[model samples]
Target: MFSPEGPTLRELAVQALSSVEHGYDLLAPKFDHTPFRTPDTVLESVAKALGPLGPFEDGLDLCCGTGAGTDVLAGLCHRSVTGVDFSAGMLDVARRRATGPVERVPAGPGTPGVAWVRGDARALPFTAAFDLVVSFGAFGHFLPRELPGLFTQVHSVLRPGGRFAFPVLAPPRPASPAFWMLLGFDAVMRVRNAVWRPPFVMYYRAFRLGQVLEELTRAGFTVDLRALPEFGRRDGGSPRARLVVARRPDGATPPPAA
Candidate 1:
C-alpha cells in the first residue's frame, strides 16, 4: 500500500509515538507517498459526482492534508479555493504542491488563486464564507462524541444552502477479514491510548456512517447521500463509497447553543 517514497516503518513508529499535531507535522513531508493519502481515483470520482452541484464561488477543503481535496476545490470553485489544516508542516507541502506540475480542471479564467490556511476543524476561523466545504480521509481523527461540535463547526462556516460534503466508504462486513483487521486496529489503539502519553488519535474503525448522518442532522444540516458508482457495489448492491452531502438551509438560523 506504500511505496519506497513513503516513510519507513521506523519513521512511522516514531511519528505514531508523537502527539497528533506533532506526529502529522513529522509525517507531512512523506504523506503523499503513503497509503494514508487520498487516492487520485477517489478524488476524481468525487469531483465528477460534485461537478453538477458546482460553479461554486468559494470552497474550503477541511483537514486538507497535503491538499488532495484542494485540487478538487480548485477545479469546481470559481471565486477562490482555500485548504485549512492545523499542521503547518502539512500546509507547507500543500502550498508547494500548488506550484507543482499537477494539472487540474480549470474553474475558468475568472477563478481566483488557491490559498492554504492553518486552522483547527473543531473551531474554524471563517463564518458564512464558503459555498462548498469538503473533507477527505480525516474523520477517524475525531471521536464519535466530538461529532456534534465538529458538524456544528462545519455548519457555522457555510453560507445558508452551502454544502458540507465528504465521502464515506461502506464498512466491511463483520465476518470479513478487512473488518477484523480494522476492529483489531481500534482495539490496539484503545489499549495504546490508555498507556501512551500524548496519544495518537487515529482509529480505522471508529467512524460509523449511521452515527455521522444522525449528527449531521442534529447540527441542522439537511443531509443526502449519493452513491459513487466508480467503486462498484457489494452483493446487496450498495455502492462501495457514498458522498454525504449536507446543506445548511438557506437563510436558516442555527439552533440555540447549550
Candidate 2:
C-alpha cells in the first residue's frame, strides 16, 4: 500500500481482517516499503542518543520487524544483539536483513553480533539476558490493560541495571488534524473489533504516555526521558519525540509477599 513494492490495497484489506500474528506474516515481506517500518532518521537518532549510555554486553530489539532496531543495537552494543518477534515471516525478513547491507554505528570500538528469534512480547522467553532492549512502532498492537504484563516481561529479560527504551512522539495537539485522524482511526478499529471475531487489538489512541509511565514504574523500572534532538521541538518547547529509557534496578526479583 505504500509503494510499488508494498502490499496492494486488496492485500492490506485481507491482512487487516486477519489475526494480528497472521496479518504481520502477510505483511512481513513488504513491511519495509510501508510507513510502518521505523524511519532511518529515527533509528539514527536513537543510535546517537544511545551511544553514550552503552558498552552494553547483550541487547535486544523487542518486536523487531525487519531488523531496523537490531541494526541500531549492532552499532551500540559491544557483545551481542537479538531481535525477537512473534511472526515467522517477519523473522525471516529480519534474518535476511542481518545478512544483507549492515547498518554501521560507530558507538564504540567493537561490532556486536546479531541474531533473530520469533517470540511473543507479552510472554518473552528469556531471563536476565539483555542489557538494553528497544522496540519501535509495535506498541499499538498491545491493549492498554496488557501494559503491565508486557512491561513486566521486558523487565524479566533485562539484566539488573538494563534499559528498556523506545521513542514516543508527543501526542498531537487536540485541535490538530493529526489528532482527529488518530481519533477516527481508533473509532474505526473499535467498531471493527466489536463485530469481528478474534479481534485485531490495534488502536492508535490506546497507549497514553501517562498510563505507560505508570506501568513502567510499577514494573520496577526507574524511568527517564531523553530528548531526540533530530526531530526538533514543539512550540511549547517539549521535544517532538522523546526516548523513554526505563532501567531495571540491580536486585533479585522479590518473592510474592504472603
Tens digit of per-residue lDDT, candidate 2, span 47-72: 89888887798889999988898888
Task: Quote model 2's TM-score.
Answer: 0.93
Q: Pick the candidate with the highest lDDT.
A: 1
lDDT by residue (tens digit), candidate 1, 19-74: 89999999999999998999899999999999998768889999999999998987
Off by over 4 Å in 2: 100-109, 252-258
lDDT of 1: 0.88
| Residue pairs in collision within model 2 | 85-119
Candidate 1 TM-score, true structure as reference: 0.95
TM-score of each: 0.95, 0.93
Give lDDT: candidate 1, residue 5.
92
